[model samples]
Target: MKTIAIYGDSISTGTHGEGGYEAMLKSSLSLERVYNFAVGSSGLTRKTPVGMLEVLDKNPVPKDAELFLIWHGSNDWYWGSGMEEFSHGVKEAVDRLRAAAPTAELVWVTPIYRFECPDGMAQAGEAYELPNKNGYTMLDYYEELEHSSKRLGFPLIDMRRLCGIHRDNANLYLEDRVHPNRAGYQRIGAVLDREIQRFCIY
Candidate 1:
């Protein structure tokens, strides 16, 4: 029985009765223990010093963890964080995780597609531009995460591409255009189970 630690935002925390992807993965893999260090509305970078990295530093994961899964960046993009800050925060978080769990296999999961709604669109208006204009879209974050994963020697799971959430399938998977619904969580869990099996040969 292997121990897995999940670190991320709302997607990993889940909403209401869904229990998120972590719970689903636990059941699917039949693991002995699963630790969730995810928080709602959290991101890699923040204006103040209370972000994911800070949280992780304050409350480190168990050293017995065999796998460390990180899924972040959506809130960072929504909050207009710069790419450099995002990258730095990720590096810090990864370093902390590695130091805490030296033998753990690290995996980074990219952000998924978020649907644009009328309220958010109205807030943005016609002239409102993206926060990180250079790396605006979720895909840009995904690319950056992929690059970081390669540089840090961590395997990456491209959730955006693997989940296939788009304009057409937004209603089917997403609950509020940003977070996944129960069905969506199930789909993501299935894919993650397969990926974990392929990556870890326990």
Candidate 2:
């Protein structure tokens, strides 16, 4: 029973703020509380008005929060923010979270594979092959996440690599290649549960 705080974009908001993996995790475990600070179209970059920094600024982290799940960054890739700006935003967000929740452990969940196809099985395109307007692929954004996790000294739950949701099986997990439907959310919830619970071992 941990009081977890979640931060992310539309996926974290979860079908009108009550339908994503956060809900699945809460219901499945019957956890006491979950503070969702996610907003639609949010990202680590400052380009978006509802960016992580903005959300953090608006919602102060509770002192009693035990775990902070900083799940974000997809919109940055989709909106075509450069890697350097994205990385800077991540660092700033992490620093602010650390300042707000000194005792809470932080986890970074990287963005998963995405295609434009919505609500169905993916076609033949790979996520990495599709670049945004700036010609930077989702892989670029994901790599930045890896670097930030290591540099910031936090665990990274790399969905792109580990979530089992990819071009081949996205139909089962994602709603629009961008957000997870019920099944997709559950899949992510299970992965998150397994990953975060490992922290209790020590």
List TM-scores for all candidates, in order.
Answer: 0.87, 0.88
Candidate lDDT scores, in order, read 0.74, 0.76
Q: Given candidate 2, what's the lDDT at residue 145?
A: 84
Say which candidate scores most in lDDT.
2
Tens digit of lDDT per residue, candidate 1, span 33-146?
Answer: 988888787877764235687677678578998998888877676665677877787788888889887888888888887644222233431111232434365555666788
Off by over 4 Å in 2: 16-18, 27-30, 117-126, 200-202
* Residue 76, candidate 2: C-alpha displacement in angstroms: 0.4
Structure candidate 2, residue pairs in collision: none
Candidate 2's TM-score reads 0.88
